[model samples]
Target: MARIASEALIERLAEWGVDTVFGLPGDGINGIMEGLRRHRDRVRFVLVHHEEAAAFMAAGYAKATGRIGVCLATSGPGGIHLLNGLYDAKLDHVPVLAITGMQETSVLGTGYQQEVHLDRLFADVAEYNMMITNPAQLPSLVDLAIRTAYARRGVAHLTLPNDLQVAAADADPYEHVAPARPPQTAPVYLQPPGIPRQEDIEWAADVLNKAERPAILVGQGALHARQEVLAVAETLGAPVVKTLPGKAVLPDDSPYTTGGIGLLGTRPSEELMEETDVLFMVGTNFPYSKFLPEPGKARVVQFEADPVRAGARIATDVPVVCDAKEGLAALLPLLTPRDDSAHLAKYQKMMAKWRSDMRSLENPDRDPIAPQYAISVVDDLATDDAILTCDSGTIATWAARHWTIRGAREFYLSGTLASMANGLPYAIAMQHAYPDRQVIAYVGDGGFAMLMAEFLTAVQHRLPIKVIVNNNNSLGQILWEQMVLGYPEHGVRFAAPEADFSAWARSCGGFGAKVSKAVDVAPAVREALQHDGPALVDVDVNPNEPPMPGKVSYDQAKSFAQAFLKGQPHRAAIASTLFKDRIQRLGD
Candidate 1:
């Protein structure tokens, strides 16, 4: 065992329960790469083609497993490449640690090759950012970086100079900051911070109890507080509307759950939202302030673990700053169950109708195969414990609307940032994190092609990740949005040259299935799931399908109509789908 600083750093990482790191090879990171070689058994390095994918993989791991995800890259361009995914983790409030290799210690600031101000570059995204200038600082700095990421639930960064990485270790002055082994806790929260004050919880409970038509809106922050959310919903007989990021918090099928509440939401949620007298917003900063209760009309009670985000969006009459689960536990007993079940019953009826309408959309007998049909088929074939990831596009809409999250099924959403090319890397990381669990990435053709090469990474690792690609040959979301905005989709309308995606998967030593028929979707997904390693199911879907927003404004209608008058291609298909959806919205 050589006493190199890189080995010490790697050892410290291993102590922090990091068994894997996603990164790529580079000259700047040779020392760290050598360290990885030295400690090959304990901490395996997953080689990725691009640094961005590595960063995304790390974020996905953190989101999926509720642990600090680790990614590595070299200085300059390599370090800069990580910002997108790091921002994803930061905005989503997932714990992630990014380590980058720097130029030699000798070159301070001489504009060296591949040189960039890495510390200042990462300052905005990282809660804890540091440069390991000396061997002595490595141990404490690394510990703090990891701890800060976990404690703050955001990105943490450290830059290791190429010289110091291979340099001899400093004497063991302080005891190791991390634990000798991973904690044996069933479900671990890195740093469980605050508990809600008794008086605060009581006040929150009282407000909801007195209100006649209280509505609950939950988000990603309240993921672990499902039972508490249900309890509150049951107590007040309120309809629960989930934010897009909180799609998996409660099963979409739950009578209390009114699906999503904005553009990618159900009409029932929006209708119930306007009708509610009180808005109990728990563990969410749902960005669409327009969809929320009016400032004066509805009393807003927001419960959040992060105090910084309290009242960040809509005005909060009562801001309860605490962990959602803990706050709800304290508040649940204080509230008396509501006698009037009119609001809840009304929303339930609306939801039932919405479900039926959605079912019709999914089962639509379209020629090119409706996207919803394929999505719903995949959803049906999904295992109870499957971990799902949706790319940022129309596929996300499909997942948000159609996916059934029952039992242990969960979704990893690239929330807030809404970046493309995230699904494959995300699914890869999840599969790597929990090899035994079933992992699937619901990606659009555009997004899938963006990081399609990562499929090889999964194959090389034998991860058994199933990727269901909506091969629409177009950026459907953008095209639809362009039409909605009264602009002809110019740059985005063209499809890529013909390429065999499933065949490529098979060529890469993985299972491959290409489905063009609606009937083949379920069978394709089932086969993909049963494959030994990575399996890609490329399902050709209709390109003209549009994601019907929950409520279409007059301006939106005007713009869309103008676009239609201007002769947008496949106008009939989109118009027909819109007609059916609008009829359902009108309660036809």
Candidate 2:
């Protein structure tokens, strides 16, 4: 109950339920470090080599545990380095509290050693940014920052001046702040001042009753409304198609759930949407507008939490601005139980056929190596409760298509940002946060190389993270796009000598292997899994094979061509790759 500045901060952090702190020590934050040492039994500080990795580690932990993940850094560059990871957490909506040390408060605006505008620099990435100048502000500021992070679901930065860390507070009285509670009643079901006209509900019910094949499209918002979504699907006897972000909202094996839709989606889901007369988009933005059927062809109904997102992607016959769960719950009672079990049965049959056909594409006999086959082998060798982190590009597509996620398993990725260089660090963080669970990173050569330096951090901590690099020596996604867009692929290839990733792993005092044939993949992965420390498996996969499962349209092809002609390299490549195989399939 002493009034020491560092102790007060630690006491406040403990009240916030922060059991683990990811960071390293520096002179500027030495007082806080000294306090942490004194209170070592109360809080555990996880040290990392780079401040950036520390922030990412916190982010991964927050995402997995659904709590505020905390990280700390010293003054100047140390604090600035945390920005990249903070930005990642901000974009992904992960709750993280980042505490950094600044130069002495006495030298405010004057040039001091390691002095920088830490508060202003973190403005864009943090929901709340404050520099604590007075000791009395510590308790309120800490409480406010924690509350803001939880409420906004983003990063909050707290900068402590070096002088403030040792400043004695006049009062040591600490008040506890309770965590935010989930709404008592679901937000969506609550009607505003004007009641919904009975006719509106009747019309929606009529549309459902008349349509022979109505498809349900679900997204991330469905996570909060799983029961409602299932209830609505069951009432209407409709097949549900989920987006990648909504993967586990419904059980993958549910008879009512066909799978994801769009470029990397399964054939049955795509076909079902194309054939359906009524498309109900629930809680999903589904960024690819080209994948959507024409609004006029199919009556579209949308339910979302935000009013602005109700009809952004497609024209909607009905748009409801309630929580996805609330909206579905309200609509469920109005719907008549359809006897069209046969309609749902047909879609189920088609889904089974799609799953069987896609399994054949994994070619265990391929010579160069199919990435999908490699993923299958890894899946087989991995623990049932393992955590899988995937990087962007071909590997992500392959993993999404092939990786089987059980209820016990946790899937973490930058799905919204779709950023590269996240796999290795993400795996390290997962291993750190959940030591008992096996953590694996499925990354491509391009992505792995981008954050290759983080491999040392894994080794330093002796984290048993297994990194599987799909080594194609090129950006596979870009190559597919170039072929589709009628452009000569340039700057996509890494013509430089390839690093021996296996040797690199060994150099860092961990297990490593280079897998060329399909037969060697499982054994290599098994060996890496058995290692006590970090490991890497560099698998050489076929560069020509496409990543996504489905095809694109003629309009998509045209858009890509226009972008390519204008020299928008990355955008053009994405457009071309997305539509390449679809164009070929149509031509045939």
Candidate 3:
């Protein structure tokens, strides 16, 4: 029995363990769409507003679930729209499969309607890009597109010609190809392939055993290695600092935790690294080299799974190319737990005071509401198993500091891409992936407005995702950056009558609210969280409140002064806040 290529393709996707696909219906993709309709029992296609959002939703799904997220689109423009989100997946090192339908194979180069060079367009973003024109290529291509996504941990693309999609699958019946690794849904997911060499582990242990002030820097890779990382930290009595993506690697309330260490990071993390004699870089490639201690200042020992990224950012004194968990577990036996409590004690006191100061900020009785206060309220109310997504901007800074993720709670930022408007898309995917779990998107007004149309998608699907809008009325982070560079802020303001996102949500068959006063913030958030369907809570935030950098440079200081002289409003306020934040941390 010969099967239709499109049905075979959909069956192949189902066989690859993909249950949900994010995409839209277009005429060029009708064959694939029909295939989806036929396979409705096995796969569900999530309708999205734009092809870009579909791709972003796939990326978000992959990031949150650690599975191969799939997205579909038509030829030309639709294929182009997938690029940005595919890049997000690629740069962040997540597994995603992008399936695009092409114009007929016969008219590929004839400048036909909606025909474009998709392979060339997707080349830069996808690790594996292929075209399926022949029925025989359907099974292997779909398998490779899926397995390669998992194996490479990046984007894999498959372009199907509309003509071939509905054609006969094969002269013979189809067979399923088993993946090398067990699916995440299986009774047992595959373990890491290898561990570090004993010599490498021993060398790292020797360095840790000798150092007085050793620290652990974590990243997204540390998620699976939490126990091993904690063991290593406990043995050395080290303070663990986190990258933004690594924010949930260790709970902030944990004994060794020191929040994060970048522009949006904490003082304790910065101090911990600056004072560290030995820094064990674990599973993170925090790109800001300056945020790290000067090369000669700290002896670096890196425990990385990927050999390419082992020491790509900083100088590696001892490089252990192995799975972080496995490597740390092996090194534990060779390590000696230290008795020097001074280093750990010093930062612990500072972290304690920092937490205290942050508490006051979170409880501020400011007019038009402080961003931190509402976010902190969210922090307190979120369930331990909640899935939270944050947009890129000053709102991200507030969320980074205020929201404390622990237990089974998961946190996602855009990571390297840092693109705006990702929060809502991410939340949509999260809600779909884990419908039973609580999903929240902390989006800025700027970011939310960019992809505001996606709210309708959430409503259409009856997804119960809570969206919290930080209506700052400006590109807050960029304004701070401009001031820091001694340049007057330009094109940062959203002129006149702000966006009423809550009203838009209600129009789309969902609940909505707008909160401006301090008193209404918590209740609005609480209401949104408790809503049975998709909801949006829009809260007006002070535009002048800046999220300052961890360590100010001489040039940055000079620039701020110049901007102040140029009559930049909030100049003194930002400086005063920065000074107070640092000065108050000195006592502890």
Candidate 4:
């Protein structure tokens, strides 16, 4: 009846407010699974079909909730499978704790079964990585790992050997050490928000006041400071441009706000960046520097929580290192509000026209459903508070351009890492966290097919997630990338006999539907959304459609044309659509 090390670990995590853990069970982790079984009331284990999906789910959970997410896996391959998703968490700077099983301590260096030196493997991905050799080390190690993940806002990893996991909690060589440290059992609270100095705020305000035209660029870091962002934008009469992960920072329908920036951004945003004299970047290290104001052309004022990341992306005239909400709030009062509406009015007009142009592309009657139209339908029908997740690829373009983040709606994707197949897993985690809310996954055929098995996890858990697969039957993003880069399209198309994802969903006891015609897009999406259980809608979007960039350069256009001249395999099908799209945009 003696407590085990695994039980102590679980109990400690529960005290830190972790109610769920995402992972799969394997013999290598049997002791940990047993611990979970014993502590079932305190923490529930979410069984995933793949360790990769488990990691993705953990990262997703952390991204949505702003809390530490935990995932577990068995030794060797199971532990290895968590690398990609853990990297996603690391690069995105989200707190996640990854626990992996390992071989018995005695057989670790002997190359025993499932012994892959997990701590070493996870070294690069984890900010704090360690393997627990002694059972007595469990409590302090757990506390440190959890605290490190919180402090760094990155992944923390721990590998526990099978034998030690079940070791008696009383086994303690370190208990006798001087200044006996006890395990921290209280719930962890975030440290106080860092605040910028009055001098720095005054300097940033001075720079902003002198500029004729100021534009605000926000990333995910600004999500918690929505009101502060709005106040600053309103005071400066500036256009607000959001990064992909920062989509929910402000209402997309706000006249002062331009949807997103970079290749997947809006024309208004591009125009604002091009013309603005001052760039006020808030809580975002937007990576696409080319889309920003020309290096020396605009003075940059950035507010970043981490001093190391301050001014890391663009050249800054003033770097305000502090929490975004606090920094912006402090800076707001010092600024002389701009009364001129010309700068803000220009982008608002452009944004209105840009929206109209987008609507023109979403033709409901177009045969062979346009991906834009399909996603737009889902957008129009989604709940105001719905949490939407998207995968990497052309589907991202569609979602970025079409989906309007308004009301209490939230959006997430693999922004920094830009990994594929994260949409479904993110949606699953969001649904698990908010079972009563509407959760949707907008994924491309290529990304969805990578980890489609996770759908069964949804079915098993009875999570009512609606999945909208843009079935283009090809790697749409890569195909267009090749064409735009002047390379002949090759290796982008999937082999013949495309998958019937809807059928697969049905097989897994979930609602399934397919929409092949434009007219069916809305109805099919509605049916899927209304399903009482998990649902998948496989919409056959036009493969010839192009996910055009915000502003295509002359070289890119010429390169695309060159690809067609070089006998790009679907050039005929794509050329007509491209021509039509160009003609429509030219008029705008």
Q: Supply the global lDDT for candidate 4.
A: 0.89
Clash numbers, per candidate: 0, 2, 0, 0
Candidate 3: tens digits of C-alpha lDDT, residues 1-28: 3457889789878877889999978887
Candidate 4, 100-152: lDDT as tens digits: 99988788688687779989888899999999877877677888998899888
What do the candidate models score in CA lDDT, each in turn? 0.85, 0.77, 0.85, 0.89
Model 2, residue 175: distance off in Å is 19
**TM-score for all predictions?**
0.94, 0.82, 0.94, 0.98
- Give candidate 4 misplaced runs (Cα > 4 Å): 173-180, 183-185, 583-588
Which structure among the candidates has the greatest TM-score?
A: 4
Minimum summed lDDT over a 10-residue window in model 4 is located at 176-185
Which model scores highest in lDDT?
Answer: 4
**C-alpha-based local distance difference test score of model 2:** 0.77
In model 2, where is the ten-residue run with the lowest total lDDT?
186-195
Model 1 lDDT, residue 303, Cα: 94
**Higher-TM-score candidate among 1 and 2?**
1
Candidate 1, residue 265: how far the Cα is off, in Å: 0.5
Following a full C-alpha superposition, what root-mean-square deviation does model 3 have from the true structure? 3.6
Better of 2 and 4 by lDDT: 4
